[model samples]
Structures are given as structure tokens and as C-alpha cells.
Target: MRFDIPLPDDTARLEALAHLDGLVKPVGSLGRVEELAAWLAAAHGSMPPRPLDDVRVVVFAGDHGVSDPAGPHGAVSAYPREVTASMVRVFLAGTSGVTVLARQVGARVRVLDIAVDGELADVPAEVTAHKIRRGSGSIDVTDALAPGEAERALAAGMAVADAEIDAGADLLIPGDMGIGNSTVAATLVAAVLGLPAEDVVGTGTGVNEAGRARKVAAVRAALARTADRASDPLSTFTALGSACAAATAGFVLRAAERRTPVLLDGVFSCAAALVCAELAPEAPRWWLAGHRSTEPSQAFALKALGLTPLLDLGLRLGEGSGAVQAVPLLRSAQAVISEMGLLADLA
Candidate 1:
């Protein structure tokens, strides 16, 4: 299915190149800033790429079936599944890293309760509820989600993108928060790349050696169930992606369709981006990787997408913190390309 994602506008992008070349820097001295400026110009489809006037961070919250501490992988979580619900409250209270960085950047924070395993009592009126299922089925035993549930999550994500655009958001960042999420991400990556889980899986949420071993085992067993379907992105997602990742994939595609630029976050974000790329080949054109995470699977995903991140501070924190931290650099790049004095004029 060819999704409706728009191709980057080459004409405007060429114009942006000319505009950046006209700046006082000795042609590309600004490095990735120039690269980002060109991409913004294409994505915005306008000259000067307009300052990043408004940015929106959407945190997709869910819980993993592997997170049942009483369940088989329960031995794998640094925290319980209930923490997913509690963290939603923390995000709502604006005390998390994403909230603080977004507030500093003058951006808005919107949390979506797509499939949290527990209740978020008295959630703010704005929190979008697009829960496709209470929690995913265990991929090691069965498909994480039914195909119909995956489709519903995708449509809900598209709707969220439309709502943000209507509300005047020019830049969108999708974040993921879920317990035992790394297992899901690792499963998707391993299956898609036909890689052994040991190469792709890592210590998530600060798991110990034994926990990492359990995660690897779970991912390997899941891929055995995934066998043929593993190579197809959407099928892999249906087979093992967390609800949050699947929704983020849809949101990424929809944002690209709207021509909004996105700075993608770490491992889980890259996993979603892989699905986005698979669903629509042109989707990655409208986004940039904000950082390369410590997770080996994230690197594998980034390699597949052909995106190079702007920073590498050894960051592994999710919730869009790494992506948001790169926003100022985006602003600086825009300013340098749009406001710096021309070299000819200086001469």
C-alpha cells in the first residue's frame, strides 16, 4: 500500500541550497547545519524554511505484555508495567525531561494513551486515547497485535498528525514510553534484518547481564515465530511492535505527508521510522535522526533508513529528550542560513 506521504520538494530545496551558499560561511563550513537547512527547505516547501516557530512533541504511551513482572519476561524489566501509567502522570505534570526541554524550546507537549496496560485516572482532557488494545499479546507466543488492531493504531496516528497541523505545529517529534519496549524493538529489528537477537538486543532500562540474556532469548524465540513475515515491515510490526511504536510509525508517515519536519529520537523511534520507510519509501525524506543511540538495533535501523543523526552524546533516554535537545541546533542552523551577513557584503 502506497501511503500518502509527500516527496520532498526538490525545487524549493535547490533554492534553499543557493540561499545557504550565499551565506558568509565558506560554503558548508556549518556542516550538518547546512544539510538540515536544505532538508527543512524541502520539507517546508518555502524559502528561508521559516524559523521553527512552533514545535510539538507527541509521546505515545503503551505497555508490553512482556512487562508482567509475574510473567515470563517479568524478570527482564527494571520497572513494572504499572510504571507506564505512573509515568504518564509525570509527563502530564511537566516534570519529565521531555517536558522541561519542550518548555525551554517554547514547544507544546501532548501525550497519547494508545495502549497503557493500566488506568490513568483523571487524565487531562487533551490526552488522546487511541488505545487499540489494553496491551499487546506476547510475540514469543503469538502476534503482538492483530492486523486490524495495527491498522486502527495507524489511522489514529494519522488523525493525531492532522490535529497537530490544524493546531499550527510546524515541526513534530514522536516519542515512545513503554515497559519491556526494547524487547519489542529488538524483535522487529532482528526479524526484519534477519539478524540474530544477540547482535541487535541490548540492556534496556538498565537491565543486568541476566536480564539482557532473557531479552535476547525472548527476541530469538519471537523471530522464530516471525520467520517469513519478519522481512515485511508492517507484518513485523503486527507480529511484535508495541502499540506506541506502531502509532508512532503512522504519525511519522502522516507528518511527512503534511510536509512537517521531524527530529527522530532513539531506538524505539528508529524502529517506528523503519516501518514508516517500509510503508512509504519517501517518508524519511522529511525527517532527520537526532542522535545515534547506544542500542545496537537503533544503529541497524538508522543504517537501513540512510539517515545520519546530528548529535551523539551517548544518549539512550527516550521520551523525545534526545530529539528535543537537538532543536536548538536546528534553530541555530536556520538562523545562520537566514540571518548571517553575506560574505560578499562583508568583503
Candidate 2:
């Protein structure tokens, strides 16, 4: 689908900045929150950007077939593809951390079964199923997805974003739900940032010390497997990423095209942002780094994106729960920009 939203007007943004400077508080005292409002206005081509009343979170779940190897981490044999659907079921049941946090922030949560292999019979009505393939091909031996499949996954995500926008969703938070996703995330980060696997690999889902070592080794193997392939961003994604990664990248691009703000979660989300930046550089301006995850690779990805997260609660959850926690702060920033009294008015 083609999205053709116009860029924000420069003159209108300048005027909004001036008005912000004249607010009651000290200039720039509101920090990133004030900047966020100004950014919204700039994105909308208005003096004061309007708060998005319809906030929806899309959590794309997939399965990675590359977690079968037994290495220094003693082989994550229990991390099966079925775990992807199991956790997604938990998310749909509103029992996962992401569901709880989203509810607290007044944001609707929607789970997408992008490429899970098993049947999700008990999935809630709100959860969407867009299974592109049973599961991604094993990156340890070959590419994770076919080139055409990667593009289809991306388009699927864009279609979801379009539908959400059509339904009046002003803000979009595209998240991920998959076991062994960190391996893909690390590879994507390493590929896009031109870094080695060791630099971007980290233990995910509470892996022990040995498990962390094995995860890093798996990333190296995947990188080596795809070494002869082109270093193009899409190529890297199709080689090492899951459907969740491609979908998230598409969601980010669509959000930028519509001038909507996107709150990024942890490493998985950041990996998607890296792909989005490679595809559409301007999209990062529309993103807000919600928080820094406990994962080391998340920090590397955030730094690569030049985004300082609003919170540093040492969160490592991937269900977009970390991002949801920052909604209150964003709301407070909007309040400061639009509701705070002027000095003259107080006098």
C-alpha cells in the first residue's frame, strides 16, 4: 500500500517553538516531553501538536527455527517454536506484562501471529493472524526467509498500520513476541551497524552465562552463513531476521509516512528501527525511545539510532511493556506544553 502524507511545514514548526519558549516554565525545562510535543506539531504542520487519542500497540509474534543448535549455552532445547504461540496466547489473555502495562496507559493491545507454526485455538478475538510461513528458515544454515516472503511480511505490517490509521489510531507501537528473537535482533543490528556479532549479541529471556556465550556464537554462525550475500539492509533482514522484524520495520515506515509517533520497545524493536532507518532514514525522527533495556545489544542499537530513552529502569521485556511504561511521561509532557500556565497569567 502507498502512503503519501506530506511532511510538516518548517514555518509552522518555528512558530510552535517560539510559543513553547514563551511558556511559564524555564526555557526547555520540560526536557524531551516538550520536544515531543513540538515534534508532534512539526509532524502535523500545526502550532501545537494534538495528542493522539487512539493509541494501539501491535505485537507481532513469530517463530525462529535456528534455536536448535547445542553450543556453549548448552543448547536452548526447551526454547521451541511452540513457545512463540504460548507466550502470544498469554499476551492475548491480557496476562503478560505488556498487556498489563498497556492497560495502565490506556492503550489497546493487539497481537499478530505473523509466522507461528502451530495452531492458536484459544487466541482472543482482538489478536490478528497473518501467518506468512510456518516459521522462518534456519539462519544457521541458510537464509531465514525468502526474498519475496520478506517483502510480503513487510507489506503485511504496513497493511496493519494502514488499517489502524484508517480506524483513527493516532499513535502506533509495533512490538514483537517470539522465542529466540534476540538472536535475530543481534544479527540484524550487527549487519546494519557494520559491527561484529560479539558487539551486538546478548542473552535474552534469562539465559545463563553459558547460554549468553552460545547466543553470541549462534549470531557469528549466522553472519558467517550470510557473509557472501549483499550487505543491503533488506538482504540482511531476510537472511537473519524473523517475520516480526520485517513487520516492525514496515510499521515504522508507515507511521512516519502518516506522521504518527511510534514508541519503540527494547532490542527487538530497535532492531526493526535499524532496518527502517536503512529503508527510510527520516522515520527515526518520528520515533521515541521508550526505555533502555537490560540487554547490552539494546544499548548499542539505541546509540546507533541516536536516541536516549526516557526511562532506564533496567527493563529487558520485549512485549512493548517497557515502552508502555513511558506513556504517562509523554502525557505529562503534553500537559506541560498545553496546560501549564504562563508567567503573566499567574501574575
Candidate 3:
């Protein structure tokens, strides 16, 4: 679905500001929440804005070519491609905790396949296939994805966001699932935030001490291999990131253009956010950092982006689970702005 996000009308914004001024509260008493509500009202071309009731979480799943490298942090031994397809299946079956929490909060979860290899058997009806390539190119020795493939993955993400908005979704959560994605994510963070690979690489999906060391080494090697390329941010993604990272970056840009808020997941999601911020600096205003991960690199990325995480429960899971869990808190923030009576009125 093609969508053209309209800018806020001047008349509508003026009316919203007037309504906010006349509300039963001290001027600027509710602080940033009130400003956010007013901004939403203006974005919708309305006064006294209504709550954004519909929320959809779009999880993009793919595979990383870096998984085949001769490193200790390579793909887990128990499962290979099956793990990617299997976890997606679990999500579609509503058996995963993320699905449970989303259902509890009345949010719809949509899974998108961007670059997984092979066809999924008995695919659930909710999963949408938007594959750009069978899988990304190997980043251990070559570019992660072709430049054209990077654009295609980005367009695929924007397409999903457009479709969800047409179906009445006013807020979006872009999640990711791909084994060995932390390698790509770490590379992206290092390139954008100007940090060394050691500061941005971390143990993803519960890697142990030895595995963590291996992961860090793999990232450093990749960074060293790509040090001389003077490419732009998009080139950085195509060179060293996965489809999930590229798509998530596009989703954030599209969401910001539409003035819709986005809930971000962990390191991968934050990597995407950093890319989106590079593409459009104002995009950060529409983002809410969901949680801080147990991964040290995630903390560094968050700090570099100047974000204060809403929760820090030692979460290291990166399948949008942490972000989904924080949805209620976002709603509560909105509620405080929309429903609370002002102290001045009470007095």
C-alpha cells in the first residue's frame, strides 16, 4: 500500500494549542506528555486529540550470512535455519511470551519475512513474505547485502508500515528475529556512533563467557576488514548489516514521517534507530526506548543516542519482547496526559 504522510495543518495546530491552553490544568503542568498529545492532535489535523487506540508490532525476521564464519560465535549448534523459521512459527502460534503480552494489551502482532532462506511450510496466515533476497551476502568477507537489496529491504519495511496504517494502526513496533544478527548490529552501531567494535559488540541470545569473547572478536575482525570504505550511512548498512537492520531503519523513518510513535527493542532495534536518526534527526522524537539490555553494547548505543530506557530488567532478548512489554507504560504516559485532572482545577 502506498501512503503519503501529510504535514500538520497550521489551522489545526493553532486550534490544538488553544484547546490545550484552555484545558483544566495549570499551564505546562503535565510537561512533555501534554506536548506530545498536542503534537499528535496537530499531526492528525484535530483539536483535543483522541487516543491512538490501535497499535501493531511488526517483527521482521531474516538470516545473517555472517553466521557461517569460522568463529566461536557462529550459529548455534543445535539448529541452523530451522531456528529462525521455528521461532517465527512459535510467534505465530501465539505461544511466545511476546505474543501473549501483545494480546493482553490488545495489540496485533504481524510477522514479516524479509530475507529468510527457503519457503516456510505451513506458514501462519499472519506472516507476510517480503523477502529481498534468499539471504544477505556474507559480511565476514564481503558486503552483507547488495546496495540494491538494501533499498529493497527498506522499501519492504515502508510497505508494511503503510499497510498497517491503512488498517487503522496509529503506533508501530518494529521487532527483529535473526540468528547472528548481533554481529551486523554491532557493526552498524560502531560505524554510526564512531565507537570501536569492542564497545558495540555483545553476547546476543544468551552467549556464555567464551562465546562472548568470540562474538567480540568476530565484530572486531569485521570492522577491521571494512575500515577503509568511506561510504554513507546507507552504504554502511548494506555493507555490514542484515535485512532486519535495514528494514527496521526504514520502518522508523516511515513511522516518523507519519508522526506515529515507535517502541524500539534492543541492540538491533537501537542500531536501526541510530541509522534512522542519521537519515532524519527529528525521528528520535517519535521513538521511545523500550528497555536497556544486559548486553554492554546496547547500553553504549542507548547512551550515544541520548535515550533514557523505560525499563532495565536485565533483558537480553531482542525479538521485540522487551519493547512489547513496555507498551502499557507508554499507554500510561498517554493516559496521564489525557485523563488526569489538573492541580489547579482540584484546588
Candidate 4:
């Protein structure tokens, strides 16, 4: 997969900086908020970006065989695999963490069952339209997806992004919902960054010490098995990531290609961003780290991408909760840029 993503507009960013300095405040009073305003302006290719009126958060749901209770290594997450489907229902019912926060920020939430292991009943057809498989292969012992399945998942993600942008979404947040996804995400990060398992593994979903050890072993095994493919982002993801993650990578890459800003949430999205950066080195220009997740892999990925996060709330809940929380802050920055008076006007 090839993407010729153009960097965000530099002229607009410089102009935004100058505008911020001219505002009725000290030159550096706003600190990071000013930086956020300039990034929005640059991403939108305007001095002051239009309000984030139609923000959309797309949650890519899936299942991982490595999390199977019957698998050789047993479950890696605190929650069972069935929770993936149950959370999908919760998201559809508009009661999940992301949904609740999205409402607060006036953003819409879309949940896609990309690789859910079980069939969801009584749900809208669009949610499962992009389903790649029941569950991804157990990455510790087998490839996460066949090459064809990986490509299809990526295409599905790109299509979803296009639809959202076409529907007038001003900002996008890519969320994730999958049991045992933390293991998959950590593995991908370890492989891409050439780090050891302990460096990236964490207590995903509040796993115990033994569970964390299991996750570390799984990540180490996955990295060793996929070592040769580490140089190729798609190949690495195909081996160590779930279909949902592949879709997330595709979604991020396409968003950057369209010059749309994306607020990345948690470790899964951070891992996906790493893969996208490998595919298109300039993709991070249109992306922002919504928060610093509790996952160590997220910190590693952010450092690698050279992007500082906006918040460090110790949030580990996936499904875009942290990003949704950060939405209001971005809007506040936009207000300062668009509505604040200039010092000259005060004179």
C-alpha cells in the first residue's frame, strides 16, 4: 500500500502563531493550547480553523484468538472475549464511555464489528458490513491474518474514513474495542520499534501480574516469529495485529492523505499510528496524540513519532474515551484563536 500524504500547511501554521501572539494575552500564556490552535489551523489549511462542528469517532471492534480462554496461553485480558460483543451492544446503545463522552463533545460515534468472533444480533447492518473474520489468528502461535484478509481489512477502514469525511466530519477519532487487543497492540509496537516484550507490555484491562507476564511472553513470541517482516509495516501488522488494528492503520493513513486531523486514543491507536508512519512517513503531521495512555507501548510509540500528547490523565480505557475527553480542549483552543480580540483592537 502506497500513500503520498502531503504535510500539513506550514504557511498557515506560521500565520496562526503570529495571530496567537497578536491576541490580547501574553505571547506564551496559552502554552500548549496555542500549539493546538496552530496545529488545527495548519491541518485545515486556514489561519483559524473552522469549529470542530461534526466530530466523528469510529470504534473498530474485533476479537483475538490469543485471548481465547481455551487457547494454550489462556486469556491475556481481565475481560472475557464475550465482552467484545457486549461492549459493541453498549456502544450501539450509546452508553459506552466513548459514546457518553462523544455526546458531551457533540461528536458522533460509529462502531464497526470488523473481526468480532461471534455474530451480533439485532444490530444495524452497517456495523458488520466490514467484518473480515470471526477472530484473528492467535498471534503468539500463528499469523494474525492471511495476506488477503489484511488487505481487505485495510480497504474497509479506508472506505469508512471516506464515508465519514464525505458526511462532513470535521475531526476524526479512531477508537478500538476488542478483548486481548492489548496483547496484539503491544506485540505490534514491540515488533515495529524493535523493543523487548517487557518494554511494551502492560496491565491491559487491569490484568494481574501473571496475566501481564503472559502478555509479555506472547509479545515476545510474536516479535520473534515476525522479525523478518519488521521492515514492512503491512507485513508486520498482518503477522502481529488484529483485523481491527489493520483497519485502524488504514483509517489513519487515509485520514492523513485527505489532510484531515485525527485524535488518536490509547495504545491500539498509537500502535496503528506507528504502522502508518512507517507506510507514510509524513502521516503524523495530520494526527495528534489525544492523551498519554497508561500503556507503556503508547509512550514508546508517541516518542518514536515525535508527537507530545495533550493530556496525561493516566487513562487506560480504550474506545476513544480519552480522545473524546480531549475534544473540548481542542475546541477551546479554536475559540481562543477565532474569537479572541487582538491587542491592536484593544488599543
Candidate 5:
């Protein structure tokens, strides 16, 4: 509740726009580039908007018990449950797409083992155990977490944000690495937006026809269990969302509280962004949609958040890879804002 959210400052926005008008070009030649510069100014509540030079991508890795459990459990992912931990190790080893992308963006990567099912053995120093639990309860059958699990997960995320900000990370990207998380995000989107599960569910991780059908059913069940209270952030998160979702929500909330901008990645972080929106209402002031995930619910999440993503290359990989891909654009937005000369100066 202490998101202590900042309001978008029109004065800062106007100041940025004024500067943009002075630049050496047609008044609006840069188009959305000018709009983005103003938004950065508004988000920071500063006229010149501090540069996003220290972008950090923090990925919350967890495992879900709802994953492709054997037999009657059905498949929520095309890959096995082992895939979550496998990808976490991949992230830790610096070979994952997100790791490679983060390097390309000149951003530091922090992979946290929040709640992977099996313990991550000998994780790198950059990877730490912020484990809220080994794995979340299956949402299709029952509440995915206990009454207080959402708060704990959220607190863990806030702590992560504080540490990163204290250490001088100016921009943050919150990513998720749980295999079955898209299902939960779909359920969250449906429940929060008051839509049918079918409207928000998507075939995550390239599931087959049968697997996609099973995923839809899981989302419906999870939404049914949530009932009302979708507007209640903690209750909604505990009932139908995963720990990684709650943690990502917390991370976003903390970033907004500190007025540090966030690049939210994919559907998983969208669900978390929804949680922050429900709780703080003004949190989106400090956030931007990094990409539109291939997940169907991601579109709904983006619409609900009123965010137009920076890219949409049909990215479905969710290790913060898509979000990191947009950092260069943020840098570009800053560059065009700060470096372009006035027409008089150009002459």
C-alpha cells in the first residue's frame, strides 16, 4: 500500500515538449519519439528526465506445480516442469536469450530463484534465493497460495527493487521465468478485467491443440475460484496468480514508489502490472510496456494498462528477453531528447 506513487507532472511534460520544439527539426518530425521524451519527463517529474543509463533487468524465476503434471493433471506447458529450473540455470549461466540480450543492451542481469520447485544448486553469486516457497499451489484445483503468500512475494520483490535502486540502477525491467506462468497471467487478466477465461487465455509455450484446450480449462477454473475481489490486489494474487506474478507486481510497485521507470515484459509481468494498477492506480505513471508477448492475454493486459508497446515481433520467450530488447530504444529516446540541436544552432 506504500507504493507512495508519484503523479505524472504536466509541468515536466510541457518542459520536455518545449525543448523538443526547440530542436533542429520540423516541430514534430520525430513523432512518437517526441511523445516518448515527454513521457519520460513526466514519469521522472523532471524537465530533462534523468538518463536511463543504468538499466537493470531483474528476472523472478519460480516453478509452478500446475505445470505439465503427469496423467490427469494435464499440460499447461509444452515443456516439462523441469524446464523452469532448467531455464533458471540457463539464465544463471549467462547463455539464455535474455542474458545475451541484456549484454546487447548494456544492462546488468539479476536472476533470483524466488520459488523454483527443486533447489537451484550452486547458483552464481548474482543469483540469490529469495524463495517465497518451493512452488505455488495449483490454481486450477485451489488457491495457488496461502492467505499471506501474496504479501510475502510482494515484499520480496520490493526488497529486490530497493537493493537495485540503492546500488544505482536507474531503470528496471521485471521479467518472469516460470513455465506455467502464462496460464496464471491469463487467469489474472480475465478475473481482473471481468472477462471470460476464453477471452484472455492463450496457448503458451507452443502447446498442441489438446494442451491448449487443457490450458484454457485451467484458466477457467482459476478464474472461477477467484470469483470476486479481482479489484483487491492481494486477494486476487493469492487466489489465482503465481508467486512470480506477485513478486513482479511488488517489484513494479516499488519502482513506481521510487519513481524509477520500469519496462514490463510479456503477459506474466502484465498480470503483475495489473495488480499494481489495482492497488495504486497511478503506478503506470512510472512504467512502459516493453513488448506485446505472443500470449493472447498480453494484449488485454496492455489495453487495460493503456500502454502501447515498443515492439511486437511475436516474442513469446519470457526471461526478460523481450524487455531487454527495448532498452536500446529507451537509450535512443533519451539521445534524441538530449542531443538534437536547435534549428538556430544548426544554422
Candidate 6:
């Protein structure tokens, strides 16, 4: 439960900045790209960090009962809750947005079903080995998880990170797949940041105006329910966060613990990261905002985390697409820092 992880090496970052400045280019022509390289160097504690040869994307999939059309809250998503399971099949078939992008960058993709509502046929057992329940409870009226489920989901995420790192993943991207997840994520953000529902709720999954209003109302109710637990991270998560999001929080914490650079996708990732940062204040140093998601909560969460996004493409998709889109740019930054000739060498 206690992260207490070390921050990246500042000495290595300073040295990398010096090396970038000494490169055959203007003092700050590369802009944030230069900063990105320095960050990787610091994360690795080396002047020239290792190549991002093995990038891995882990998508945590689940269902939110609040999204159930039959539920009293009604569906706040454009898609039905059944789509969560269908999307998992698409991910397993390697045809999802995250999978396609990861393939383009030669990165591996693994979709874990942390709390999908129903059974998934033809899926590898490893994907569901950490399944905590059928689905998380509706946060608007009930706790997202029963007691002790949050801890199990967190441990599942940590184990997944360890396995990926042990398998030679140099870079990691945590994605999300679930209908109405944005509602769940926005609720978590509002609770942890003391923000009102209007500030955190958005048009998640292409919801209409009425749907957005419902979302805001739902978040407001959840906030009131968990207002007292906001100071305690675990209690807050248990009350307002989905199982997949709790797992995502654990994944972020463990990646920082291992000093592996992480590219955060969108609202889901950032909201979970907010909880992780509360758990370990130093964890955000090892993370980079992959892009500026259109999700209002994402922007607020990134601002809270003090991260600058590499791209601002108005992305609202949550399946790590934004992070994957920024991979080439990160690699270019890595190349400039690790391969560009020093000005003195040119002389």
C-alpha cells in the first residue's frame, strides 16, 4: 500500500540536457522533444538511455454497472454495456485501435479482463486470471468494489507490471476499455480533487446532452457519498473507482517503482494516476502525458500531476491510442539525444 518510490535521477537528467545542448542544433530547437529525452535518461539513470525497443501496452477492461441501460441511473454511454465484452474480443484479435497502433510501433498489447461482467470465450486464461468480479458496482448509489477487492485488483496490476518488465518491456502504456468508464473516472477525479461535478463530467462515449447531465448528477451523488473518504486514497477508490481503474493505479505505481517510463493515455489513465500520485508523490516523475485528451477530467488530472502532454490532437479515445500516436515522437527524441553527433565531434 505504501509506494515510497524514488524519483528519477536528477543528475542524469542534467547531464542529458547538457549533451542535448551540445548536439549540432540550436539551443532549444527541439522543444519538448529534448525534454522527453532528458526524462528517459533520468529514468534510466544513464546519459544515453536504452532504446525503446520493447514498448508494451496494457489495457484493463471491465464493465460499470452504472452503464447498464436497465439500471435506475440508465446508460450514460452511446454504446451498450455489452460492448465492453465485444471490445475485448476485438483487442484479443489484434484489431482494436490500441492493438493496431502498437503493432505499427512494434509494441506488444495485452488486454486484461479485471472485472468484465460476463464470461469471455476463446480468450487466454491469463487475461482473466486476475478477474476480481463480474463487474463493479454502480458508484452513483453503491461502492464500486466490495471490501478487499480493491487490494486484490491493485496486486493484480502490480504483478502484471512485474511480468511485463521482466519480459523486456522498456516502455509501458496503460490503456483502458470499458463502457461508461469515463463517468467512473470523472467521479474518482472529482472526489480526490475536491472538484464539483460540472468541472469533471464530460461527453463520455459520445453521450448526448441529457446523458452528460445524468453523468454530472451521478458524479455529484457519488461525491457526496464519498466526501469523507477523499483524504484516504484507498477508501476513495473503493467507494468511487472501477476495478479496472484501481488496477490501472497499481500499474502506474509499480512502473514507477521499477523506473520504467510510462505514456499515459487519457482521462482513465490520468484519473487513476491522480490516486497513484497520492499514494506515491514521486511516481509522476516517471510518467509522461502522451497527449491532451478531450476529456475535461483528463486536462484537470494532468494539470494536477504537473505533466505536459506531447500532443494535443483532441483525442477522446481511451484505449491507449493517444499514447501510441506519440510513440514515434518519443523515439525521435530518443534518437536525437542518443545518436546525434556532438558539435565538438563535428568540429
Best model per lDDT:
4
Q: For residues 261-328, what per-residue lDDT tens digits would candidate 1 score against the true structure?
A: 88899898888888778788888988899887888999999889998888899887789988988899
Writing each residue's lDDT as its tens digit, candidate 5 over 1-347 gives: 64578777899899999999998888998888788889998887887778888999999988776784662448879888888888888877789999898998789988898878876777765565578888888888777788888999999999999999999988999988988988888888888888887778787888887888888888877776567543478888888887888899989999998888899999899888986799988898789999889888889889988999999989998878898998888778778887888777864
Clashes of 4: 0
Q: Tens digits of per-residue lDDT for model 6 on 1-347?
A: 67768879999999999999999988989998999889889999988977899999999999998887777667789998888999999999999988988889998999999999967967899889889988899888899999988888888898999999999999999999999899988987887788899988899888898999888888888788766653677777788998899899999889999989999999999999998888889899989999998889988899999998999998898899999989998899889998898889884
lDDT of 2: 0.79
Every candidate's CA RMSD: 1.6, 2.4, 3.7, 1.1, 1.7, 1.1
lDDT of 2 by residue, 250-317 (tens): 88888888877888999999988887787776678778898988877778888878899989998877
TM-score of 5: 0.95
Output the better candidate (1/5) by lDDT: 5
Model 6: ten consecutive residues of lowest lDDT: 226-235
Candidate 4: give the clashing pairs. Answer: none
Per-prediction backbone clash count: 0, 0, 0, 0, 0, 0
Residue pairs with backbone atoms closer than 3 Å in model 2 (clashes)? none
* Model 4 spans > 4 angstroms off: 228-230
Q: In model 5, which regions exceed 4 Å deviation?
A: 71-73, 124-128, 228-231
Off by over 4 Å in 6: none
lDDT of 3: 0.73
Model 2 — which ten-residue stretch has the worst lDDT?
Answer: 69-78
Q: Relative to the unseen true structure, what is the Cα RMSD of model 1?
A: 1.6
User: lDDT per prediction?
Assistant: 0.83, 0.79, 0.73, 0.91, 0.84, 0.89
